[model samples]
Structure formats: C-alpha cells, structure tokens
Target: MYAIVEIAGQQFKVAKDQRVFVNRMEGKEGDSISFDKVLLTGDGDNITVGAPAIDGALVGAKINRHLKGNKVIVFKKKRRKGYRVKNGHRQALTEILIGDITIDGKKKSDSKKSEPKKEDKKAAPKAAPKKEESKKAAPKKSAKADDLKKIEGAGPKAAEALVNAGVDTFAKLSKKSSEEIKEILTNESSSLAHLDPETWPKQAKLAADGKWDELKQLQDDLNGGKA
Candidate 1:
C-alpha cells in the first residue's frame, strides 16, 4: 500500500518499506511522525483520491536520520572593485521510513481472507519454465521494430513519424526517404549520422532478431572502416 502524504508543507509519494528525505523537522532518530494530510491512497489497482485531503486519513512514518545535503559553494564578486565573497552551504534534511498508511482510520484486512499454513506453502508446485519465443511469434514485433529505428534520439513525436512513414523495420529504414532520415537525424540528436548508415540499419536488424555474431561482425566492420 502507498499514499501521497504532506509533511512540513511538502507532499511526498510514500509506500511501505520505502525511505524518503525531506527538509529537517523537529525530531531525532526513531521518532514517529504522523502525516495527517493524505492527498491520495492506493492499494495496487485501486486508488482513492481526496478532495484536498482524505477525511481521517493518516500516514505513519519513523524518522531514520537527521543529516545535511551536499555542500554547495556560493560565490559573488565585482571585477576590480575589491568586492569578493564566497560561502558554502548544506541544507538540513530528515530521512523518514514509511511504516504504514491508514485510510479512513481502518486497516485493510479482509474479513474473508485467512493466513496460509506452512504446509500450504510447501505443497505449492514449482513454476513451469518460460518458453523463449522469437519476435516472429509476437504481434508487436513490427511496432517495436519501428520504435527501435526512430527512437534513437527522437521523443514521442518523431517515433510517431516513422510509424506513419511505413518504415516499421530497421531493414525498411535503410531504404526509406533520406529526407525523412535527415529530418529524424538533424531535428533530434542521434549517433546514426556519425557511423555508416548502412551498417547501423543492419546492426539494428540483427539485434532485433537476436543475431549476436552478425551484430558483432557489423560492429567490427564499422570500427575497421573508421580505423
């Protein structure tokens, strides 16, 4: 279970067994602090959002440490006017561990559920081995291929462009519009421009298909040409 809690005028996303650092509060090690401002609460799939804050919701946390942040050097100077000042500062911080998050002042224990016995754990069967399947067996391989090609340095928009341009595979990219390639390469920053475009396409295709040795050969070829 997790919650968005407000403490010391700051909101933090916290979960059980997680540690968070915030501006130092009035507490020593092992001191418990209850965050009354719970903006939201979530238990895996289900989430409860508050209208400002959930009524009677409280998140309990344990103070782990009181420390200081990394030292930052602040300097100020006026040229040739004998005005020079420098100072170092480290912000105080408090580390807290989220103990438990309670919503509506009630625990999340289901009345229908019962604890499993030790024998029940031992009697459980082992999981079956997962089969290694190739991209040929998956429907999303083509979409993934398109993503792999155009996602070199481009964000979501450029990825959409390559997907729309019918260049679904790296093999297709090697032969697609150079204008589109340049647009993708120049508009965004990618190493595809520095290395041989031919070798890059082949390498990407081999990697997608899990041809390790062929990929190595292409890398060697590119390096050799550079040498």
Candidate 2:
C-alpha cells in the first residue's frame, strides 16, 4: 500500500521499504520517525482520501543519514554600481526509509517539526578567553582592515563582502580556507554571491606579506579571480 503523507512541511507519496530524502531534521542517524498527516492512501482497488489529513493514518520512517546536497553557485551583479558577488550553497538533506504505512493507526509520534537548516555555516566559532586577555588581543588581531580590492580577485563588491564576513585583514583572509571564505562571501547576509575565492587567499597571502610584484604576476595569470 502507498500513502501520501506530510512530513517536515512537505508532502510525499511513500510506500513500505521505500527511501525518502527530505530537508534536514533533528534526529540523528538510525532514529525512527512517523508522520500522521496522511492525505491519501491506496491499496488494490480501494483508495481512501482525507478532507485535509487522515485522522487515523500514520507513516513510519527511519532516518538513514543526514548529508549535504550538491554545491550551487549564486552570482549577482549590479549595473553601474561596480558591484559583483559570487557565492556557493550546499543544501542540508536527511535521507530516510519508509518502514510502514498505516491507515487505521493510533500509536506514533508525529514528526511534525524540524529545526532550521540554513546552509553555508562556517565552522563553530572559537570561544573567547578571559576578558583581560580578550581586551589585549582584540587590538592586536583587529588592525585596520586591508584594501581587499588590492587583491587580484577582490573587486569593490567582493571586498565589501569580505569585510562584512570579518575577513577584512590580509592576514585574516590568508588564514581562511577557500571553502570557509567562499561560505562567508555566499552566506545569506552578503549579496556578493558571484565572487570566486579560489585565488583570494593566495592573493591575500602575498598582500599580507607585502609582495606586490608577485601578486601582480599572479593576478595576470588569473581570470575572474581564479587561478
């Protein structure tokens, strides 16, 4: 038998032993989940439908794993504004298997809610130390932001995004991984989603180290800020 049920704010037509991948959910792998918002059910020649949702219908499912979908590039440019941005997104996904479908069901915990699964999250931020040390370290680490536009791939828009994401310093930009930097530029808050950061760090490293000639050469080799 197959049943159309709603789970995690989406409807799905599921059958026994069938796998279903949905948005990221709270449960870890191997946890069991159920849905009671069955809208329709069919078996042989009989089909049962609900006005909005079936009162006694439930669909059981088991969490197989939680994973990320493919990387999607987002690019934006503004005319005459000298603004261009590029970013990437990877959707968080949860894979589950439909274990059982019940029409006249009573026992099940409705997996009605799921947590926020926004993407492009950076690594967990490091905790701060004592206040005295933090005060002393702040100024030393937080110098005047570098001119990000001086770097090969960093245009005005890309520079603005890097500054907003706390990668304003050449040292800071050089220290970040390509993926992490990419995530920062493409994060929801920034509009510079078209910025490619592949060679950004390399350029930043040269800038941080004050190698202008080398940076110029590298920029000559790059196309649209890529190496």
Which candidate has the top score in lDDT? 2
Which ten contiguous residues of candidate 2 have the minimum total lDDT? 111-120
**TM-score, every prediction:** 0.43, 0.46
How well is each residue in 60-154 modelled by candidate 1, as lDDT tens digits?
88999989999988666656889677778787788999988888543333322233334345755332112224434565655456454322333
Misplaced by over 4 Å in model 1 are 77-82, 106-227
Q: Name model 2 segments beyond 4 Å from true.
A: 106-227
Model 2, span 1-227: residue lDDT tens: 99898765568888999988886776879999888889999999999888788777888899999899999996766579887878788867889999988875433213221111122134222322343588997777556777888877666656767787777889999999888987876773333555678888888899899999998888876666875
CA lDDT, every model vs. true structure: 0.63, 0.76
